[model samples]
Target: MQKPEEAYSIRVIPDVKIVNKGILHTENKIEGEEYRSYIFLNFERITNKGYEASPTIRDDTLYYVNTKRNSLVMQKEFGQPEELFKLGKISKYTFHDKGILVIGEDKTDKKSPFVASKLKYRFDSRGLLRSRLSLYLFSHGELRKVVSGDFDVTDVATNGKRIIISATKEGDDYGLGDLYEVDVETGELKRITKGEGTVVAVAMNEKGEVAYLGHREGKTPWSTAKVILPELGITYQCGKTCGNHVLSDLFDGVKDRLIFEGDVIVSPGQEGGEAHLYLLSDGKSQKMTDGKIVVRSFDYKEGKLVYTYSTPEKPVVLYYEGQTYDPNPDVKGLSPQRVEVNGIEGWAIISGENNPTILFIHGGPHTAYGYAYFIEFQYFARNGYNVIYSNPRGSQGYGEEFAKACVGDWGGKDMNDLLLFVEEVKRKYNLKGKIGVTGGSYGGFMTNWLVTQTNVFSAAISERGISNLVSMCGTSDIGFWFNAVESGVTDPWTEESQMKLMRMSPIYYVKNVKTPTMLIHGEEDYRCPIEQSEQFFIALKMNGVDTILVRYQQDSHEHARRGKPKNMRDRLERKLEWFDKYLKK
Candidate 1:
């Protein structure tokens, strides 16, 4: 959708030190591309170098892990980043309120079981570290390493029971994950759930009781059970189907609201899987909102819930200095237009006042395309493409019932939703002759799926997508979990596996593809590893399909989206070029 004159165009946010950083924190990017390398934290006035994506702010201090440096640093007075500890040869340092913590094998003279360590520090009410404490490692040697320096901390939360710290880690197989809770004080560690396939999410109530989500294990795709203090001999179970839930967002600090470690559920597979907020009050659990909502953050003055919301239809707007600006302005220019496609309600975005549109497909067949801020979508809009993305059948923003509708169906009904959505957009926008499609992960799978099943779009780009369920079952980090849940397949390789998985796999229908397709992948990605791309690429080439494959060797499963600065820039450029070659009129 690039205008003839828009070629050789560059977008730079004027005077604003805002970087279009990826979602997860990692250093992976294509070489020699234009991108935002540094961004200044508006509140802390801290200028973060390299890729500083997710920031956790607490007590006026800001905490972030630099993937480029592979180190954790603290910044006070918005000064230079101070190195607190080197997790070198180990894993990256995770930031907590007191200090940075690392979890890994306790490698020392006395090797012990898995151990987690933290650096201690003294901080003021504003959250700037006043002094440093002995580096505390729960390892055997009994010797703690202390590094002296001031610290920067933020996004610190506590229910007067425990200090909760949020950070990310490189998973064994699924690239990097956004993790929470270092438990610096009580030495209690817990993983707050996000992404897909997470059965349970844990939180702490005011009484220090742990709340956890209890879902049916394995691939049976049962109901979800929200349990409060199940591990502490106290139990309150919300009896619901236990399908995989992805925590879309969270809110903390509600007056008289009891949130335990286990009282969280992403979107269950019943409705559209649209996320909703619930609270336990007066010994009764109550549903808060009825529509699709994602809790970005919470402001509690004396523990009263002020307001919380997320971007699903509109970009998140922030009021600053008596002025309002779209925090996700990349999506600011996009105008959300609604239309009914074959009796299915859907939405699409029109960029600016002109240009051909790119049909943006989201992953999670059960996930909904709501008002969320997506950088990729923004860039597509910035580059003069009307990027239209939606949450089809499996999307979470709808509700539990709609989300579950795609469970065993896979690409059947969901595929129809996308096709109908596109048809509706075309009719509404009078854009019948020009259209393009692209997505990653499940979205990627669908891109591949779409290219084979139909030639609706002029071009396609599939990133970290899947082609064959059989190979993906073994190659993916969560393939076992995915196969079991969606297809109810005990053995991915067996012919008797889910009929839909085989029928929907793009590789089975590659011969029907006529669109010029491009494949992008991260070499080390184990979740939806490079093998998925490779399988599709091989099939396309063998069938004489017009295809190209680009792989980022330095990245893993995450780097594809959240990799280095240079790589992100290159990816956008390449993607634009691919679409330009085919989609542009």
Candidate 2:
């Protein structure tokens, strides 16, 4: 007997191409075009090692710190890629006219082949290994130490005389930080912000006005904008008062204007909707792009805007001067219908009538499902399955209160929201008895939790899920901080906290699960770890429930989304097969 044909092939899905800190390639041209078309440069391509950070350009030379090779490369005038220096485990870099500032950990101690850097290792009290990120300044073929400290810098911006950095100090609450200014001439460091949420994406205008994006307590999206003048100690909100828009990626535009992409939540209870470019000038805000299209990374120069645009049915394309360049033309397009389920928002991409319905949940618990292209969802839809997805409470893009509603109550209201969504979809489509469920990460946790809580669905697929929160707190990366914050536990060592974690975990109620389950995980996943799936698998086996576990060796926590091409394909095939055996039959 021969194996059955797979519904989707990885060959057609294009390689991952991301443009971070993109620079305008003025001299590049499209094939068969005589005129020079504006093209963006990608810092790194996704291969076996994964993509690197964005590149910083200075004086016709492009400089990028490759986290994969643990080195920095310089390309002068779009020539060839050349190795400039070896800086191990770099997290961020900034290019100056006089020198380059590189920040990373010194990871020459680890002996494991799977360990990418020393940052991957975790300490007992500090959770993940907290290495002192030293700052080095390279100038005139020489490297000099600028500063060395134990701070996790999120972003950095410079203004010739001063450097502004956003960082969270040791022992500070997670997702909350402060801003600091450093004088270059005297090495004088000054704390700027006074515990104002998680400050990120700092930018300075030519007139010395500073702007940043941050989120305060009880906020969902990072849309809070603050403008500060250090000389006067004056700070105020720059854009329109935050309502339904979640802002991201702040850039200094021409003449005291700031440009950013705002994900606007259109549906009442939905987490996200379409994203549009917005311009803030003179204390007023205006939408730049059409409200329907989604804009990713964009840069404005001399009134001309260069941006990458995509939609639910479109791949990422560069748009400028009546020319559009599609990076991945081979990937198939899809059309998902916008669904409003009892004041909640969702999307459905139905393939065939009477097909088995699968409800997909997104991860992040903080992240939202938007009107963008998702290859996996498209694959399932094309393979004769009704794919449904929704953004419940605790998801971003909605208001701050709605997003924070599920923070401390993890398997509580958010799970109720998902159950309501499934019931509404089943009733609307008349497919109550032929439904299935699947998700990854936090979504995976919810899948496991849902199956154990109820037996409504015929099949369940959980990937990289957290079955036991007590073990998860000690094993996964960032688990120490994340588990405490999400579970509302001030002390993990206490018995009360332990019991709270156990109550929220799915493994405690595994014996009640009747739906057939398939567990998928990456062997090297430090985020959730393979033990999570293993524990759940063992529980199901002991209960005599039908369950299968699939582990990918060469992948990590992000295997389903950003793992190797072959492993991603194999994981998807396993999911399709499991659902077919259970739901189709």
Candidate 3:
């Protein structure tokens, strides 16, 4: 049988930003493998295949970062490219009053060594903190270093005078960071935000006015972030905020989505699982873009809106004036039936009649399974298994109350929501044979927890799941603060806190789990870590439950969504094999 990855060959285009030449984005075939970029000038490919990224416009001319040479390149009006500042693997860059504010690192800088001296020493995907990113103001054919300190500058926005930057110091704040303002002349760095929640997206005006998309404080993981105009002391929050709340196989931070165009501020907003572009002006928020689509990245200027978006039926495609530039044109994937049950929103993709069911859970209890194309879901459907996934309590896109509903109660009502979804789905569809459950990250935790509570599922697979909150604090990256905040055990060293963590842990109840289970994890996944899977696998093995552990080398938390094609194909084949072995028999 043809696999779904082969049948629905998705060409993922992410890091898309609008430019004068049209839109610039990186396209790849195997999910988050953004190795090459292209410029769609009048919907035509302008550049050849190379490791290109961070495409930006400076005074009508296009410039992008070339990873192969570790330098910046200039693409002139669908013509040849010129290599500019040869920085070390440019992370992000923007033009200033004189030239460009380059946010990258120096490859051979030995003055300051990257020491893991802080409480939180590492981050997910990027691995350990090895280099310090410096800010440089390039002017008059010369580069001047701006602020290079203990903080890591991830993003920046400038009106040519005062530059607004979102950075995190070598503290224990995790992702919760603050913003700063730097004078272009004196290079005077001033604090803007009070280190509340993370400043995910930022924009600035000529008057040094600033508006950012972030949360005041994300008490729970599902807390909805807000768009704040701090200079005017105005906050425009209406069931929305900027960031990638919609979960998919594509992996890249959505930047340049919030921009100040003329008098209006265009920002992305989420409502119920679908995301769209919104215009914020004079304290009022207006929904600018429409449809059941998730707007990932966009650029708007002078009433023209060009955005990178996706639906359950389509992958990431550029949209402007009813025109779409699809990187993958001929590939067609299965669509889903959107459903809601007891305030829980879900999608069901049916491939055949009376087929076995696969209850796929989304990772981040914070991230929602929205109206976006997912190859894994299509993979299950192509194998004659109906897929059902839902966003229950503790999911974004819903209001703050709904999002925070599962704050300290992970396996309580959230578990009920999944159970209710399965019940409603089976009642609504002709689900025959046996049902299998699978999920990664937080979804993986739920998959493990579900089998312990009920023996309904015949086979279960948990990828990069959390089994013990107490041990997670000591082992995983962001585990100390993240597990504490989510479980409300601010101090896990205490006896009571340990009991609370144990009560919420699926491993604590492994004795009750009778379903045959399989564990898959990456060797380098610091977010949930491989130890999480190892613990669960051993517990199930000791309990005499049919279990096996599959470990992928040199892969991280995103191995399933964005791993090597060989490993990804093997994962899909194993998934089909496991389900067919148990469910088909």
Candidate 4:
């Protein structure tokens, strides 16, 4: 254990820009306190105002998205940022061999901002969808509007003349998107992919061949996601290894996930819990990175690869440059022992037999717990608690069908997997004073459900969790669609469907919660909504159970990750105090 004063301190690398001369990385120090960014020039720190967080290199020039100004800027060496395109809040800018592609909004469009006229307008972390993203092509110092309409484009890649994008409303609006090719000169859009489910990223080779990273038609939205080359009839979906990077990291040094060198494709793919850059050439793929490591982001040029990578035990030390740019070297904690019992893969940090145990469940019922550095989990391990976490059913990194395993089962098998994993860990470790459970989002829902199902856990904390399915459908931003697709609720308004939803809801069995529980939710959480926690807290009180509802204002569903620094520190302290009071005894 270490001093508590320096406990909530977090250091991260937000943007890592790779240039010809050297590597440019922005490091944020002292999280939740005074924020300071340090820019490095080839492993050495430098400062430049015009240089944005994540800048792209195009013909010895830099191009970046200025979110504050809502513009795309061009900057040469030792020059001020020149506004190239001032579209509404430019989120992404791509530099291809042919030209530059920018995506943002059209401020000239006369429409009420942040207001959606549809059933599913709002989303978690991303609030109301007031307007769709507008795509523009900046070629030869001239800006041209290429795409803006009913279709919401998720990802795009270009060859200057041909633009390949992924959008949901291109044809049969089943919320499933297709790969559409847009001819920039003619302003024509054509769908290329056939069996489409969900497309996360897209890429195009020099030969104008398009490839998408996603799954085909599946049982639900949480389908097996992979990179597919329809022309080559090649799908990069793997069961033994993760087809893409699915875990969250401390520093997401932005660069590129998909790289096309001629017909050869280099992409980030995860093996087990760690991610590696996989090169796919001649219709065959092989990993390029060595050792057990987690690559957050990477960029390549002139036969040299620059990356920001980390592990549970350490930080990113660029292998090519032979330099270490560790964000928090001094802030080290307990390491984990990877384990798998009954097909449920997980990690367990064993301090001692006397220490209590806390089972950490990941959100996304779709996201997996992998080889990423988590400060909260590290703190829990440092505070004399043996931590156990795993990717149960409906988790990514385990192929497509496995992710859809809990499509209609929700808390059924996933809950059982967690319970079973924890029991096995407890027995294998042979020492546990008390057991606690905690998670956010979907994990929060499981926390509430697990407590009600078994008395194995002495305390539990649910963050941004779901309790009532019937209310969530109408209240949450993505509730209507998420519930229908995830929970198999075809008709939510029907009495039969309502009964089925309630039967699967945690609030329906709140009376069965014997554990001392804590509900941590955001007042402005639009995904699960704050009402979920309030309802569960009220029911727990009515049943004479010890429960507390902690709410954070000015925060959405991402309170734990990207919330206010002070708020993040306060959250950690609150969880520690709650578990200490209930589980320490």
Candidate 5:
């Protein structure tokens, strides 16, 4: 659907101060289907066939890092596509102060079992990073550091003199993170802040002001602090005297002023909600947006402001003038037919006005696709194919019962609900019985599981998915806790339990998959790490199934959802490419 430019919608234009262009996206709460509500209303877009889109621009070019494969890809021209660089787990990069910071690790640790290392890079004017550094936990259980004298030429970030690095630390009691500033020319290290609490976000101002979110002096509450160089003086505190609360990095580096959002968190038994947005300048502040606007994103250019806002009754929209318009209004280029299967309601978002549909299975095993910002489904719909997304059994927000229905029956009832969704969408829409199913995380797991359970889908995209529950039981973030609940396992290693885990694992049943499949993962993701993708890809390829793997470096599970602007764009592009190659006509 094409929207008039004057229509209201929230968007991110190029910031005059940064000369960068990126879109601000949001995911809101879709009311009706509460079962899978957590996964609802995420704002995203599927970009050009292979052309990438990003939320931010860095260096001279836009760069996106895929953490699963451990690679960095750069978007060349404004309207052109991106190219990926394979660096493995050796280095990480970020754009700061018009310079690129490169952090390279020596090797994985044997003591704390280095899942990953903290890296920082500082670049010179010529776009060459002079200092490459790393933060590591030594065998002594103490955090250690390293610096590299080697100079490398990369286009990730090509500006700046001094670079501040952030790293997480593990100690005898608990874990925290540290921040360090390194001299690019000399490879000299200056420890900025360490110990106690983690530095969540960092922003450096033109006047050498470093603003960040951190906990100070073993304090219980997290606050935003603006610190000065040299003596490391703390000037401003957003939450210091306000009590226990977390401030947004959006408040950092606002220059002379701080935007204080009153009480971001809603305490237990609290009614309604409140937030305050303002511009802090010269130790004084002015209100920017009212607290009642229900804004998820806002960007100010010149004196005009563009933002997105919605109420419970209205779908998400952007604002301009006095009117609001939908950025993606049910893609007129395509047609989707609604369907209800086995008492479950759903619809197929088609690629074109007429074509077979791609059955988009949502994760949470209990989540549903409703009126929210989904660029992928819209992309497929606009491109002339049908895409179907549904909230199957075990999805959330459907009161607590429906959300918990699939809790213990991972591969059983939830899978059945999806299959029924597909059958009903096909029957209702006359979809020619051709469907391509895809999802990420839990959805990826389901896609992997789906191909094994049925040959219905012609193709599948399993993104950052799980294949082996037995292995994942020992690897994932909450594997230990959730695996027992799902598999009813008393001992993860026990033969009987292992067999059951295998039975439910999609990789084990790869021999039954007839549909071509693709696997995408982030190398740095702690949630559903690359191992799961690797195992699934290997199994499928070994079984002679058409399979491909795309891995992004330094990209955690949060990359696709929320990472650097460039990464977010590249993720959507790559995902669309996979679907374009397999699901599209």
Candidate 6:
């Protein structure tokens, strides 16, 4: 095989800030020079499993959960990292002067695993076997269980006194729940906000001002959510007349203004048009960053902003003052052409003439392909393939209605959008040879469905895709609820609903698939599960169709994005080999 294409990966330098002068106003620390020389120093002494959720800064110390170990770690003065709490699957955490509060799954009960195994083969109620996470208080190196129950506490925020949390109760509409405030001492809980929408982020400033991002009950679920300041009794919306898709929570350092990252909606059915740093102050919002570039995860203090900025051709760079640090400087970049098909927006990046084109789809039927640098897309382009990706119906970044268009109609209109996209690109670019298709999760489902619906694709790769919706509903982590919500089938166990699910399943259409397809899945993938790919591979093999299945024993559904570096490379090499074997021939 051709030597692996240029190793292109994006790296983010977190917590890069410029030290401001306190009382000693030295000439060397001039604001202009400080901005220019604020070099991003690589502190190689400290490292941990990828920084979990957002790192909370308290008293000049940084604290964050480690996803790999599910532990809370603290880094003071860039010193050796200290493990504060060894928790499991910490979903959210808040640090205050009193102590640290964490919400995570309690794996203390070893019987939980045995119970899960016992209910593995059971019917729809198997969801009950799953472990329920709870809230805990970590103080003075001791962990105390504060709240333990059925609901999941997410987006935890505290203002030193009161803790504000987004509590998601099971069986709530769309599984979204309300925000509640809890007393730190009394442990009394009070519902602060009630709505049908899903709360994404929550934060409380030092002044006890609670700011949250969520869709109101009647608003479009996909529309940009305004920052709701309940304590201040004000709703802060972006200044852009166009809809703004907020991507992060209001920073905790909010003194006079609220700051966050989001994209201003430029057109209908568009995902991220141009991400910008937005500042809301004095009852109005203002765009803080350059409108042309994409800026994210910014921290503002004392009239200075530190953020990561990138363009389509440049990987993310930590920008503070005028200094810039590029983590992946050696990585090659590609400029993609923005293309629109039937009002659906996408991008096409071509490399080398007469190269086979691969249509890539993103997962999250809710997530959208934006104008950001994607290593995988660049990898494909570097490997002499034209990569075309788009956000069809059901993709976020678009308006609410467009995002919900495919909610109950997966593999229906979205599939048509994909077909039309392929047709448009083929005709627009002309001289089309063979085309390959691939994606993970929902995108994988689309790939499986596409190959069966039509033999247009010469080759296909379905990674962590769902083949049988009915079986998936019972197997996946969020299987039952997600399937029920996405398919609009409230009762998936009913005979009629089961038949409808089977009809929508790609397994039922596998017999019609003629294209050589390779199935890639992580064996430990609970979201889509290995069985989804297993069922598809078996059906294809039984029908004498060309197919192969590659399973990563140590990986999960997120292997492609978050797996070990070696495993990620192996998976990509496998994809390259599969496409080369079939499409190149």
- What is candidate 6's lDDT per residue for 1-585, written digit by digit as tens? 123334423343333333332110000011211111111223231332333434555666656666557787787865877888786578667666688888887655545454434323222212243455667888887988776555567667776677777777532324475677877666667887755666667766666667766556532334555667665677665432123332211111111123322211111111255556556655666666664454544556556666665556665666666766565676547888888988998878977448899999878787667655666777778788889888888877666678789877889999999889988887888735679999999989999999889989999999989899999987877777678667877788999888888888899888898999999998778779889999999999999999999988667777775554566678879899899888888
Candidate 3 lDDT score at position 19: 65
Worst 10 residues of 1 by lDDT: 248-257
- True lDDT of residue 530, candidate 3: 85
Task: List runs of model 6 lying over 4 Å from the truth.
Answer: 1-10, 14-85, 89-94, 103-113, 116-133, 170-174, 216-226, 230-273, 291-294
Candidate with best lDDT? 3
How far out, in Å, is residue 212 in model 1?
2.7
lDDT of 3 by residue, 495-531 (tens): 9988999899999999999999999998889899888
Best TM-score among the predictions, by candidate number: 3
lDDT of 5: 0.49
For 1-585, candidate 1 gives per-residue lDDT tens digits of: 433222212222112212222111111112234233333444232443444433444454544555455444455545666655443222323333344444322223323443323221111111112222222442332324321122211123345535443222323222122224544544455655444322233445454445444432323233334443444444443213222233221111111122333333222122232333455534454454444443333222232232233444332333222443343344333445666665455656676435767877666554445443355665677676777766676665344566577776777888888888887777677764468888877889889988888877889999878888777766565675566567755555666674556786888888898988999987767667788899889888988888999998666555443454455557778998998788675
Give the per-residue lDDT digits (tens) of candidate 2, residues 1-585. 112123222111111122234434321111221111122354123222232334556666666555457787787774877876775477567665567776666655445343325323653222345455566667878766565555566666665545776666532434456667765545456777764475645665444455555544322232333443444454444223222232111110001123322311111111256655555554444566664454555556445566665566664566765566664566555688777765567878876558898988877777667676666777777667888888787776665566667777878888888889877776776764478999888889999999988887899999988899899887876676677778888776699999999998999899899999999998788888789999999999889999999988767776765555567667777888898898788
Q: Model 4, residue 239: what's the lDDT?
A: 33
Between prediction 1 and prediction 5, which has the larger lDDT?
Answer: 1
**Candidate 5 — worst ten consecutive residues by lDDT sum?**
263-272
* Candidate 4 C-alpha error for residue 146, in Å: 2.2
RMSD of 2: 7.2
Q: How many residue pairs clash in each candidate?
A: 68, 0, 0, 2, 59, 1
* Candidate 4 ranges with C-alpha deviation above 4 Å: 1-8, 14-18, 29-39, 48-51, 96-99, 106-116, 139-144, 171-175, 238-246, 249-256, 315-317, 321-324
lDDT of each: 0.51, 0.62, 0.78, 0.74, 0.49, 0.66
Q: Which pairs of residues collide in candidate 6?
A: 35-322
Every model: Cα RMSD to truth? 10.2, 7.2, 2.7, 3.1, 14.0, 7.4
Per-prediction TM-score, please? 0.66, 0.80, 0.94, 0.90, 0.49, 0.81
Sort all candidates by TM-score, best to worst: 3, 4, 6, 2, 1, 5
Instruction: For residues 236-272, write the lDDT of model 4, one tens digit per residue.
Output: 7433443444555343434335666577776777655
Winner of 1 and 2 under lDDT: 2
Q: Local error of candidate 2 at 180, Å?
A: 1.5
